[model samples]
Target: MGSTILPTGMVFASEQNITENSSYSSSDNVGVSIQKDENGDLMVVKTETKARANVARWGAWQYTHIALSTGVTAGAINTAYSKGIGSVLGIFGLPGWAIGNLLTAAGWTNYGNSPGNAVARLWDKNHNGWVGFYKRTGYDGAGRAVATAYKTE
Candidate 1:
């Protein structure tokens, strides 16, 4: 009779090893106030805007490497339009189209229905508004990679 041997190199830990480098606590006075006007109406009003600044946004573009087959009907054009609009608007609202165009011009093309990725950072100060966009290519299904940050204005 021969004895069988099991493979080695397996290690397991019952608990995770974690270290806390710093802990912070604060003790400060906090207050809240509420006011009502005539007819018991709330005094403060809140409003929202469609587009603002200091928002970091991201978008992906996908162009099919292969063209549509002949005699094959595609879906409604509105679907693609809406998709583009929604993707862009998710970051910059109506101005996303302009930013998208800029990205296309900067080597982010829709060739073969493939789109290049674009990102933008918007900021405003003293009633002045500014938009910055970044475009890149060659991100097809590879493993994780490091991103290099560059300053743009």
Candidate 2:
């Protein structure tokens, strides 16, 4: 008698295989897979995605001078000069000149000398002292006054 061989149910099944008792599936998809390990724990696979970038904008400060008479208190100087200058600029849709006056009044420049004095000496005909205005040019790196002008003197 001659021995004979026979092929099983599925010839070359890539995903699943069928046996007489049980069946198994590959459970793998491209690089991703959904499968259980010997411990029967689920596992997931992922691919790298593009990262997002962030951006920021830069701005500059603007300043104007306020002129005042001598012997003016910093507060008074700020009120009279700063407010007036601010109001005038506001009319033209410009930023308040108060910031410049405040900075000058606060002694941020010239050893904290009265901004009023600087303005007065520079432009006041009576030399009675006045407030000065300065605007930042371009992006003020130090955030300080770049140029200054007086109310008329």
Candidate 3:
């Protein structure tokens, strides 16, 4: 496949042997699409925002790096929020724990919504040096979060 940047700034990947009658569909939430132009060229359109675009396009490498650095299995890390740990603060005793748990319950109404965030948190805590590299490579905390989300998704 090949990629082209549309005038509207959407990045599209293309396949060969497409005809004018070819159909199109988005491959993922990041907006990858396969389309046929008037000239009958088949294309995969990627209209993901900057962060999601990277993850959708280059997730394999990024996720592997996160896994190596965090020393925690991706499956385990992805389920951290659901295992009742991220849901509780528990520092100020019972009342604090109650408030923390309440917020956690509210936040997790839809569990496992974003596994990347959990992995990102672990990376942020355990891999400070790599986090710096990620920043230099244009990944802020939110970008890293999206990267993690992309991995899980």
Q: Which 10-residue span in candidate 2 carries the lowest summed lDDT? A: 1-10
TM-score of each: 0.20, 0.21, 0.18
Q: Per-residue lDDT tens digits of candidate 2, residues 49-127? A: 1211111212232334443344443443334343443333332232223233232223323423334454334333345
Candidate 3 lDDT by residue in tens digits, 4-73: 3333323223343334575333332234334433334222333436555343222321332222333333
User: Which predicted model would earn the best lDDT?
Assistant: 3
Q: Write the per-residue lDDT of candidate 1 for residues 1-153, one digit (tens) a residue.
A: 011111221111121111233211111101111122223311111111222122132123222232221111012112222344333333332222223222222222222232221211111112122332222121213322211111112
Clashes of each: 4, 15, 4
lDDT of each: 0.22, 0.29, 0.31
**How much is 80 displaced in model 3, in angstroms?**
33
By TM-score, the better pick of 2 and 3 is: 2
RMSD (Å) of each candidate, 1 decimal? 24.4, 35.8, 17.0
Q: Which order, best to worst by lDDT?
A: 3, 2, 1
TM-score of 3: 0.18
